[model samples]
Target: MFRKKSVLTFLKAQVAAFLGGITDYGVMILLTEIFKLHFTFSILISGTVGAIINFSINRFWVFKNQSNYSSHINSQLFKFALVVLGSISLKSFGTLIFQKLFQIDYRIGRLITDLFVSYGFNYPLIKYWVFRINEKQNAIQSN
Candidate 1:
């Protein structure tokens, strides 16, 4: 299992992730209003932007691991893709359950959904999996 990273690194990654999410929201609004896209489709487009920015900045700067470029890219991409799927499922399910069962407006449920995705899920996953470095790898890079 991976352990905790430095406080400064963690804070930087989180800030970058939050900023990336804002960009995603901007794209979501633009696509939905300008392009007449559905919410789901707009979310997909926006999420891609957020994921790209988050991945690049976190991998290169926040985590700051040294590895074979291809392997690091592939591993981080795979983990990030999983995180995206999990976050989406949380959002979709929250809206579905709230609207269908409790008769809540999905728009309201979306605020709840966004909170969980950003704070609850993304940080822990990125800290542990997306930026994981093995013992041997760490030892090799220390010299």
Candidate 2:
């Protein structure tokens, strides 16, 4: 059941996310630990980098659409910005809830942000809605 193309697409997305995460971690470390940037700013920079990487990989490899690159890129970027906005909101809420309500550490709050904001809700929404280049057309053609 493991077709090559599907497997490759999945692997490419996973690799992109992993590399993006590493890139994000580096930026966070530099901004937070070295440059003494605010936690929010560091998170924004790291998350933006990761989102760019994810968008690039998904557009070129996973979707493989034949649309105009410029237009596709613009729309994808817009959608990504929305997703990032949602992620940041969720992260801030998670941090407040964890620290104030549960007396949890901010690191755990970050973990909550990572899971709910980025991985869980955002991934599927971006995959199916935000970056869905050929969605309606594909549906029409298939029918």
Candidate 3:
């Protein structure tokens, strides 16, 4: 049962992430192609938008968090923002390094960085820290 639940949660989170990625990629393309913005600047703006969408879906649907209180939501959002900041830094630097060292295309570098960060960094932090179940609440429910 636990394994099943975990798998289901992971699947839901992935679907939510895919949806967010669409928003992020769309904004990045629009900014870069239409507005003539630098790719880095475009990524920054698009990543922020993606983070907002990701947080909403993860909190409400993937994690099944019931707390609607302002403080609870604010706290989760703050943690998620920090995670996003770290992820953006990782993605930016990783892309640069990959491009310079391996002569990979920037788009391919970004894709690689996204995969590494998503699996290695984002999943663990978001699961264990950002949207973690409240111990006290769980204890109460179990009792």
The per-prediction CA RMSD against the true structure, in angstroms, equals: 3.4, 4.0, 2.0
Give lDDT tens digits, candidate 2, residues 42-71.
Answer: 777877887777777776666654366688
Off by over 4 Å in 1: 1-5, 95-109, 139-143
Would you list the C-alpha lDDT of every candidate in the order shown? 0.76, 0.69, 0.85
Best by lDDT: 3
TM agreement with the true structure for every prediction: 0.78, 0.72, 0.90
Ranking by TM-score: 3, 1, 2
Estimate the lDDT of model 1: 0.76
Compose the digit string of candidate 1's lDDT tens values, residues 32-95.
7789986567777788887888887887787776466797778888988999878766766775
Candidates 1 and 3 compared by TM-score, better number: 3
- What are the runs in model 3 whose C-alpha is more than 4 Å off? 139-143
- Native-structure RMSD, model 3: 2.0
The CA lDDT at 73 in model 1 is 77
Q: Write the per-residue lDDT of candidate 3 for residues 1-143, one digit (tens) a residue.
A: 77998899999999888888778878877997899987677778888998989988998899877587899888888999999999888877887788899999767887888899888999899988998888786666447
Clashes of each: 0, 0, 0
